[model samples]
Target: MPVLEIETIRGVQLMTMNRPKSLNSLNEELSSALIRAFHMASEDDEVRVVVLNGAGKGFCSGLDLTTVDSIGEQSSRFQALDEYGWVGRLALAISECDKPVIAAMNGIAAGAGLSLALAADMRYMAASARVTTGYIRRALSPDAGMSYFLPRLVGPNRAAKWLFTGQDIAAFEAEQAGLVDEVYADGEFMPHVLRIAYDIADQAPLALTYTKRLLHASFDTDLRSQLRQEFTSIKACFATEDVAEGMQAFSEKRKPIYRGR
Candidate 1:
């Protein structure tokens, strides 16, 4: 079976991590598959949003230990520089995709698995899901953007506490700490996620993409710069056919049908 399974629902593209026997762990093949999937979504004009989830028991259990051991055996000099290699670049690609990407965490996620989820613009978790930074347990520092992301997601102090101790956080705690956007029962995860994706896809694609881009830039920009970017994007949006439809709909007091132009 394919390591990554992709399907389209409306304008949303869903990518499922398939290695159920390993709890959907990240292997080189899976990583490469994910990279291709995200690139396709970004380039496909018909795709407006992307949702990532895992199959079977958990979202992801982390990187496959067998792969790690093999890499270690192959290299004469141990190096941290090769930590992500292609996989790390894939993570960045997912993060910067023009379309919004959402993570649907159905169960526990650790190590690189957790980092992959964190790369998404939004995350929805099952009530039973959990997440942890896995480096401390393996006698190493965090990888897969964990070092840069955690402190930003949770405050630096909390990030330090969790990273140093390798603390696993429950879904409820993650929501409270601002790591997740929402939580649904395990049985309702897919339904709620699909509802959200469809709703987002129904909007103008250019507007949604610009909003996503602006949100990402806001993470690193000051208020003045972000405001300028917002003005620029809004002006750009005004030039799209969808914006004209939106205005007409407002005048008619009816729902706007956006064509994503």
Candidate 2:
């Protein structure tokens, strides 16, 4: 069976990590498949927004430890680097994708799986779902961009506590810490997430893309540089047909029909 499943509803592309037997653990196949899926969504104009979730009981259980033995057998250092690089690429693809990526966490997300959830622009978690930084428990450090993303999301102090303890963070506490945007009852999670995704998809696509880019860049760029970028992006947006449609709709007292031009 396929390790990942892709589905589209309206303009939102939903990518499901499909390894229920293992709680969607990241193996070589699933990692590569996710990289491809995110890249495809980045380039696909039809995809206005992307929602990532997992099948079965958990969102993702982190790395498949069984594969670690074989990975260590690589004769050359470069081979080892290349193999490990795929995990970074998967995280990068999600963060850099033009369309806003939302993580809909259905259950437990631990170790690198938590990193994956943090990579998304927004996260909506199920009430029963939980997340943990499990590296310390295994006598390992964090990977899959966990150190970078976690600190930024929850601040250095909270991140340190979580990383050092490897404690499970329930959905309510996660929301309070600002790690997740919203928490819904398990039964209502998908429906609410889809509704939000569709709402975002209905907006001007170019505007959404530029806004996403600006938000991500804000962390690294100075205020002056970010303002310049925002100025340039908005000027470009004005040239698109969607802007005219939006103005027209306002005048007509009707919803704008954006073509994403």
Among these predictions, the greatest TM-score belongs to: 2
Model 1, 1-261: lDDT tens digits are 998999997899989999989999988898889988888888898899999999998898888888876545434333444655755776887898889998999988998889988889889999988998887998977777888887888899988998999988999999999989999998898899989999998999999989998988988989999999999999999999999999999999998998888
lDDT by residue (tens digit), candidate 2, 149-224: 9999999999999999999999999999999999999999999999999999999999999999999999999999
- In model 1, pairs of residues that clash are none
Candidate 1 wrong stretches, greater than 4 Å: 70-84
Clashing pairs in 2: none
Q: What is the alpha-carbon lDDT of model 2 when measured against the actual structure?
A: 0.93
207 Cα displacement, candidate 1 (Å): 0.9
Assess every candidate by TM-score.
Answer: 0.92, 0.96
Residue 208: error of model 2 in Å? 1.1
Among these predicted structures, which one has the highest lDDT? 2
